[model samples]
Target: MNKFPNKIFDIVQEDLMAVEKELYSIIQSPVNLVNDISVHLVQAGGKRLRPALYLLCARGGNPDPSSELLPMAVAIELIHMATLVHDDVIDNADTRRGRPTANARWGNHSSVLTGDYLWAKAFSAIATGAKQNMLKILTDVISNMCEGEIIQLQEAFNAEQDEADYRLRVAQKTADFIAASCELGALTGGMDNRDVMQVREYGYAIGMAFQITDDILDITASAEQLGKPVGNDLRQGIVTLPAIYALKTSTHREELRRIIVNQNMSNDDVRRGLEILYETDAVEYSYTQVSKYLQHARNSLPITLNGPVREALLSIADFVGLRKY
Candidate 1:
């Protein structure tokens, strides 16, 4: 598998390989289709940032992570995969990670069931190897993720949705899972409560910034770079940070609002909206917000976090802030 040469990933290379092996082994099933779909998603390219964070946090506490750490990382990644499958179904998406989504390849019924299977497998692994507190944190993250999805659906096409609501939704949908990964890893690795909290806060900040950057990419990145349709969120009536900022500050707010509310906006309409967004510098504005969160993430790290692992964590934060994909 190809790995990014980012300093963070280099430091945790062996642990990440262990995570890959665990992910492959844990998803096996007697039923061929189940194994096929599960493996297919696993083989599909992803950064595996959450698992890396988990492993890195573990390393922060102990140079050689306990055997349980790998399984925990696998479970965290499985939870993430489960969500992506369900999200594709909800979005009626055709592709993800430059390949056909499970929902697109297998029918919604099968896809939904496969996602459930992943969730079951994830929880099963967690129950066997992780502490009760870690399980509770994972459970809460899942709940918050569901709530975030619901909020997005509820507020879809509502042009008046404010920044506060957007931030809350981002926190629940993306930040919580990232936070749990760090917290659980830190706890399992024998970090004190204070250090665990610090890492969790760091994860939350980066997670928020990550999602904001994703939203920005949906506007600015090409379809090839995004591995899915660009402007999809807008097409689905999901108002994002750029649109929100543009609506508040741009002279083209009325036009943007009209286009957004229109259920049948064409590609040209989305392009026009993009033009307005660029004119208002909404993308830059949103990027500024991302920078603030990145700074917060760095600030959340304890001073004792100063070795190579700490540097890796800090570099990961920088990558999240600046990554194009």
Candidate 2:
């Protein structure tokens, strides 16, 4: 995949290739329908950022986290892919990564089953001699993710959903999962409990920044850059950080709120909403939030974290802060 280049990826390029191999193996099955759908899911590209984060954290303390820890990275990525697939169904998304979504090509029923299978495979991989402590991390993230999704459903299209409300959903839906990936990686890397917690905190900050950046890009980025249409989240009635800021501060609050709350967004409505967002400091405010969290992620690292691993973590923060796609 053609993700933005970074120094951190070079550090784990070989390990990342191994992860891709294992992921391909897991997507295979006896059923032709399952196999075809799984292949499509694989073809729908992703940068595999979650697994790369895991491998980097594992390398932080350990001298060498060998093939033994490879499965953990694969498992983490599987869970991530599962969520994206299921989310497409929920959103009725036609395309992802510039290609037809699984639910679009096949059907929602098959797509949902494939997503369920991915979740099962994730747990199965974790069960393969993984410690209970590691398993607990996965289970906790899953629980939090479910809670976040439920809250998102309850809050969708409600213009009253404030910054605090948006953050609550973000903490559980996205940040929590990234935290689990880091924590699990550090645990496998044989770090002490104290260090693992610190790494998890770093992941938490970066996760928030990464997700918030995604929200900003949804509005400010072009369709060519994002591989999808702009203002998609707003059209779906999912009020994002920038939109929330605009709603609270912009003079056109009533018009914006009407479009969002009514949930009947046309191309013209989307254009009008974008006009309001740009008139305010919503995008700039969102950028400030992303920068703040990235700085926090950097500060969370202990003094002892150094060498190639430390540089990698720092580079990840920079990438998250500056990436356009």
Candidate 3:
């Protein structure tokens, strides 16, 4: 963000800070354990990308949207936080953003309940003032996220998973929520239906690109860079785009399939799988997909949008397609 679009955030840094302050205030709980656990998770920190994207889109439609849109922005973040908490539990993931996850620090029962608490709070915060349409978007996205997770679990270590399958999971698990964030932000900012739809698709494109880039990084990046084990997705038996591509194009296709289906993958299996990915140019192929989505994101931006906000959106799209972390 510092390199890509810090200036935009710099202009609204106070808004983001206010979000953090307000978030901390919301996480306060009567139960000591609840407070401690939720606070610990919040303090672990995140990209805050959902809220940031929400704010940017809100600002694009209304210059002074921060005061009015604060609740929705915070709700978006809360939902994101809730989803991550649940995801860590589902994946049994130990770390997120280089720190122990809530599921790692607390037991699954505690973490799951805490995630439910967050989700309830998120809806409670928005249910009072937000429009019916906005409420529907959040509810739908939450359902989609759950469905996506279920699909991923069912397809674990599925070497037969194709590009279509990969895309379906990406759309449900990641892209749809991102699109909703932008749309909700635009609605909060007072954009018309047409413009809102444009930005919605824009967010969808970037969201897809972002997840693909993440999956690419999973295989190609280091644990230190990722703040978790490299190849974590593969290690979890989650097949992504690069692996799916390699399974088709690699000369060692059968070997790659063998590695993917192997429930107990050794270090050698992971290494060999990566070799097939690189050897088949699967990484580069995945990059091409990122580029395509990014281009669509740019194309989908509202034509009437001009000036810094538009530029900020473009910069973010670029960052999503090219980020190292």
Which structure among the candidates has the greatest lDDT?
Answer: 1
Clashing pairs in 3: none
What 10-residue stretch in candidate 2 is worst by lDDT?
Answer: 60-69
| Better lDDT candidate (1, 3) | 1
TM-score of each: 0.96, 0.96, 0.95
Tens digits of per-residue lDDT, candidate 1, 252-323, equal 899999988887889999888888888998999999999999999999997767788789888988888778
Instruction: Say what the RMSD of model 3 is.
Output: 1.8
Could you tell me how far off, in angstroms, the CA of residue 213 lies in candidate 3 after the best superposition? Answer: 0.6
Per residue, candidate 2 scores C-alpha lDDT tens digits across 218-253 of: 899888788788888888888899999999999999
Model 3 residue runs over 4 Å out of place are 1-5, 63-67
* CA lDDT of each prediction against the hidden true structure: 0.87, 0.87, 0.87
Off by more than 4 A, model 1: 1-3, 63-67
Kindly list the per-residue Cα lDDT of model 3 for residues 135-184, writing each as its tens digit. 99899998999999999999998899999999999999999999999999
Candidate 3's error at 264, in angstroms?
2.1
Worst 10 residues of 1 by lDDT: 1-10
- In candidate 3 the C-alpha lDDT for residue 238 amounts to 95
How high is the lDDT of residue 195 in model 1? 90
